[model samples]
Target chain A: MLKKILYSLTAVLILVSIYLVFFYAPIPVDPKSAGGDPENFKIFYFHLPIAISAYLAFAIVFVSSIMYLKTKKQEWDIVALSSAEVGVVFAFLTLATGSIWARSAWGAYWVTWDVRLNTSLVLFLIYISYLMVRQAVDEPEKRARLSAVFGIVGFLGVPLSFMSIRLWNKTTIHPVAELNYSTFSPLLTTLITNFAAFFLLMASLIIFRIGVEHLKEKGNEMKRKNSL
Target chain B: MKFLHIAWKDLKAEFRTKQMLNSMVMFSFLVIVIFSFAFGKESSIYISVIDRKIVDLLAPGMLWIAFTFAGMLGLSRSFAGEKEEGCLEGLKLCPVDRSDIYNGKVISNTVLMFLMEITTIPLFIVLFSYEIKNIPGLLLVVLLGTLGFIFVGTLLSALTVNTRTREILLPVILFPVLIPVILSAVTATGVLLAAGSIFEIAGELRILVIFDVIFFIVAQLVFEYTIED
Candidate 1:
């Protein structure tokens, strides 16, 4: 019942958020020199939420991974694996959309050493490697145990990646406002609404992915039984 | 410490076999040679050693490439003998904490990595025709940098050791984490080589120290997870 409500709420909220983002959010004048920044800055609304969603997904993966280690429960491993897969997808979306924003805003398709881009790329690579680690192991128990470690290690990356700015004292091209931009703008309501909607979407996506995993495992078990 | 004893055993084993030492040295040398040729063909006009402007730009990058790529070869194979002879299993079956095993490999790998660096530094100098203005500073960077690299690399090599495609996976996984270390190390070395003041490179050095400490503690903490089934 809760899951059904979440799914429907996500669908409605996302549709409303889309309308608000496109038609309602008052595009800001770049505080640095008025009339600066392209209207493509609209991408900020979508991009930031997606990026935070990916981090949230990773946070889930970290917790689920630790839970799996403590309990060795099959369900915990399932949750960790599902959340990581969802997180990676969100991460890629974050990258793809950010690059589109960059092309218009930064006047380049890519910037090699920019802190925000570089760190996100690293975060993406670490989880991709986490998934790859899962592929390389065959035994179910071993794969789960090993991937949990990788998952935990990979979370260390989130802070490291986010702290790249402070670590090197590099400037970011990403539009970070002096205050959290959400509060400053009239679009604040829409942004908060969108965040809540994305959170629901993430929860539904993870639960659905876990269902898929369980079904696949059952099918594998059936095949083994038939062969035996 | 039990970890020290395990490290001593690896050292003794390595001393008798000379396997890890020999392969790591040869690979490091070959890597330097390849870079020399590639730089000669590619970067010579742009970055000749006489032209300090570009020499400092490319040299640290080249040096670290040699260290890490050659280091990968050693790290990938560090557990080969144990894997094949079932020695790791024997070690696991023994009544000691598994992290001691991890710490032991960390010590041994660090020693081997330092050896590779010391041996290759002269080769890098000779090949690049680079004068070392700040030998101590450069060596200090190498020590701290390799300390960071080996902690993460050794932890990952252990994690990937049991997998079939580890040779390729080690770098794929290790390289990203190594970025901060590589950036700071290469930049610091570049500064030192350019005769930049010690104060100029201190920031990079501090970053390397921070990375080393963080990676070491994390590696030690998560090690048991990697060893368990």
Candidate 2:
């Protein structure tokens, strides 16, 4: 029942966010080019929230991974794996939406020199490789243990990777959006609403993914017993 | 003490065979030669006619690429060798903590990487006519960067050794985590090569040190899980 509520809530929030994003959010004037499309800025509402949600997903992976290592719980492994898979999807969405935003802002689909862009790229690659590590192992127990170790190691890199450009003192073309909380605006409302929507979506996806894994495990067990 | 014994055992075996060391050195040398040949046009004894500024720009990236690629070769072999005769099983059977095995591999891998690098740097200097402003700073950067690499690589080596596609997956998984190390090392090396003071590279050095320390400790803690049957 709670899962159904979560599912319905996520669906409603996502629809409301889409409406808010397309209709409610004020299109900002492009500061650089006077004639540039103001509509492109709308992608910001989706992009930043998705990126943050992806980070949240990986954070869950990190926590669950530690729990799996400590408690040796299969459920923690499920959470870690489910979160990682959803995180990778969200990471990919962040890149795609960010690319669309970049194409309009920078006149390129991709720019290599930007720190945030490259860091996101690296973060995406790291988790994809995490999934790859899972694929390369066949034994269930061994897979859980090995990927948990990688999940921990890989999460450690995320902060350093994001901080890399700043540490190197390189300039980034990516804009760091600062929210004005002093005055409540539609932009703020839209941004917060989108954040809620995307995070709930992530939660629903992970929960559903965990359920699938549970079913797969049961099927495997039944097969083993019947074979005997 | 047990870790030292494990390292010493690997070193003894390595020296007796000289197989991995020879291949690593040769591979790095070939990489440098190939890079210099591709980049330099007119050459004579002691100096190539390649623009000094261009060499400064290229040298750090070139040198580190050679080191990392060569390092990957050595790391992949580091654990794969144990898989051959169930040597890993025997190693795990020892009374020492599992992390000792991880430390031992880190030490041996670091030693082998340093040896390859020590030879490669001079060859690079002579080939590219590269001038070092601060050799000590460069060495520090190299040391910290190599530690970060080996710290993570050794753990992943053990982890991947258990997988079917052991060798191919190491670089795929290892390189993303290695971005900060490579970025800071190359930047610091570039700064040093261009005659900048070591203090100018303070940020990169700090990143390298922290990276080295974090991965070293983390890999030590998590390594036991990776090797478990």
Candidate 3:
């Protein structure tokens, strides 16, 4: 019942958020002066939330990974794997949407001088490697243990990569969109609504993925019993 | 410590066989030579237009490519011997902690990486006719940078050893996490090469130090997990 409610709530929030982002929020008047496109800036509504959701997903992976290693529970490993898969998708979306926004806002689809872009690229690569690590291992127990170790180590590298890239390129072309929430603007409302929507969407997807993993495990168990 | 003995055992065996050391040195030598052929005098036109010596500009990047690519070769093979003779099991049967095994591999890999670097740097100097303005600062950057690389590399080396395609997976997985070390190290090397003082590279130095320290601790904590059966 909770899962069904979560799925429907996510659907409603997403529809409402999309309406708010397109028709309700006010577009900035002075975007170009600040390196933003007046229209393309709307992508920010989805882009930032998607980026945050990716981080949230990876944070879940990190926590679950630690829990798996500590408790040796199959559920934690399943959660870690599910969250990592979802996180990788969200990360790729973040990069793709970011590139499209950059094309209009920064005059380039990709900018090496932008620390955020570089860091996001590294984050994407690290998690993709996490998935790759999963594929390369055959035994279920060993795979879980090794990937959990990688999940921990990879999370630690993100901040250092960000710092080093920022230090390496002292100049940045990435715009900082500072929203004024003091007046309770429609923009702020839409942004917050989208954040909730994406978080719910992430949760719904993870729960679904977990169910699939359980089914797969059951199938494997049955196959083993039949063989015996 | 017990880890030092493990490291010593590796070195003693390596000294007797000289297989990995020879291949690492040769691979780095080839990397530098190929880079020289590709980036040497032919780009003089572009270099002239830019009013900077191409060799001076590209030397640090070239050096680190040689270092990392060669270092990757050594790291991928670091656990091959242990896997072959059930040596990993024997090592596990010993009376030391699992982290000791990790530290031991890190030391041996660091030593091998340094040996590779020690050979490659002079060859780089000769091939590029590169002159170092600050030797000690450069060496310091190289040391911290190499530590960060080996700290993470040795951990991932063990991690990948359990994989089916260990060789291919090592570079793909290791390089992204290694961006910080390679970026900071290459930049610091550039600063030192351009006759800049160590003060100019304080930011890069700090990044390298933090990366080395963080990965050292994290890898130590998780090392046991990677080696588990």
DockQ, cand. 1: 0.52
lDDT of 1 by residue, B162-204 (tens): 7778788888888877777887888888878777877897778
**Residue A55 in candidate 1, Cα distance off native in Å:** 1.2
TM-score of each: 0.92, 0.96, 0.96
For the second chain, the TM-scores of the candidates in order are 0.91, 0.95, 0.95
Clashing residue pairs found in predicted model 1: none
DockQ of each: 0.52, 0.78, 0.88
Q: Which ten residues in a row have the lowest lDDT in candidate 1 chain B?
A: B41-50
- CAPRI-style class, candidate 3: high
What is candidate 1's lDDT per residue for A1-228, written digit by digit as tens?
887887898999999888888888777667431223657867777888888999899899999888988898989999999999999998998899888887777767787767878777877888898899999988888889888888887787556545533456476656665655646666687678778878778889999899899899899999999999
Score chain B of candidate 2 by TM-score: 0.95
Candidate 2 interface RMSD value: 0.8
Clashing pairs in 2: none
Candidate 2 Cα misplacement greater than 4 A, ranges: A30-35, A182-184, B42-51
Task: Report, for every candidate in turn, its global Cα lDDT versus the true structure.
Answer: 0.81, 0.90, 0.89
